[model samples]
Target: MDIVSVALKRYSTKAFDATKKLTAGEAEQLKTLLQYSPSSTNSQPWHFIVASTDEGKARVAKAASGTYVFNERKILDASHVVVFCAKTAMDDAGCSAWWIRKRPMAVSPPRTQKPLTTRVALSLPICTAKS
Candidate 1:
């Protein structure tokens, strides 16, 4: 089947089949599929902390304004809980400009070893892996 067709068939199922918890093999299969999902510059910055315990799921739910009925209820029943986070050097986009302005200017003799300007370097691929 085509990519669009495959994606269309896949649904965001919050309500799960409570009768069964995903097997290890089934979970791994899902992980493999999730890993292939589109990422910026192939930067797959996702980590899975599978919460199989009631307490773990409870904490996750509590963290979300204490009404984590979804996570608390479904996460425990689900196969895994994937935590997605992206590494960033700045707190916000505005900080990027301040970062560039800090660079020293050329004084008569142009330094040949100067690193690339920040704007040009943004073209580099995004960080895909942590550490």
Candidate 2:
């Protein structure tokens, strides 16, 4: 589908069917898309945490509490949540901690490739510290 079509179809959902969930294939596709999504200077300094299980979602919901209280219910109701995190730094070491040490080519669909090296930090659903 075209970008305009996709954009037009997108809307913010305050409520999500609690019983509904994305299939494994659908979840993988979403992850791949987020990984390969373009960024300025190809910095690719982002990491993603997918919370699909009840325990995982609860953890995210806990972080969403307090100042982000309004997002708690929406997060719990959703089948899954993707927490996109930006690295504290964009240097080679920082990238290596999450992404490849060497510049790596973006992987396309159909083939599932392990694109990153390792995760440096635990999943923080709502990171509020100033950069």
Candidate 3:
């Protein structure tokens, strides 16, 4: 409904069911949501790594070691774990490349696109599931 309502309903998952798993469709929906999420000035300067399998989750859980160990079980038990990464910097060429990859048919002439590309930054998130 409203922003406040949505925010009020939001919560953090303290525990996850290790016996459960996400369906292919559910996983795809999550990926699509991540792909289209809004960003400041549409400068999507981030990537997402989603892990679903035991092995994949294990690998992802590695990042939660030591001081972050408290999150290891949650990550390993969840149906999916998403790691978000942001690029430190991006240039015009990088932005244009992303545009071409995302919307090949919409690309205009290089000369006409240069100015627009210069003002944009891009980030692509790759999804992987290992079995």
Candidate 4:
């Protein structure tokens, strides 16, 4: 399908035709598309977890505020679900730690947004002082 059609048709599909299943190749294609999705400063902070099991999907739905609508029965019947998570806080880089430690959030002036420039600058792979 064209990008526009795909974008328009791609709703938050809670319900799926239970009889359908994605082939290995089709699943790989979906992963490829997901990999190209946008990220801040090329951080690619998102992680994808694919669950095809009804129990696993149910657990995820329960963990995500209980109203996520995984539909255990549909999960058992349909294909797969992808979970995305950000990986920002899990980094140990010196610059990343610097940004986190130096960013005056709660008590600072509103113009502390300069820290965002610092973040984007650090996020770039330019290798300023140390990684």
Pick the TM-score winner.
3
Alpha-carbon runs more than 4 Å astray in model 1: 34-38, 66-71, 90-113, 116-121, 124-131
Tell me how candidate 4 scores on lDDT: 0.61
Model 4's TM-score against the true structure: 0.53
The CA lDDT of each predicted structure is: 0.52, 0.67, 0.75, 0.61
As for TM-score, the candidate ahead, 1 or 2, is: 2
Where model 3 places Cα greater than 4 Å from the true spot, the runs are 98-131
Overall local distance difference test of candidate 2? 0.67
| lDDT of candidate 4 at residue 31, scale 0 to 100 | 90
Among these predicted structures, which one has the highest lDDT?
3
53: Cα error in model 2, Å:
0.3
Runs of candidate 4 with Cα error greater than 4 angstroms are 1-12, 69-76, 88-90, 94-131
Better of 3 and 4 by TM-score: 3
Candidate 4, pairs of clashing residues: none
Compute the lDDT of residue 122 as modeled in candidate 2: 20
Better of 2 and 4 by lDDT: 2
Candidate 4 lDDT by residue in tens digits, 25-126: 998988999888875555555678887667766766565545744465555556878878755443336445445554536343267455443544555543
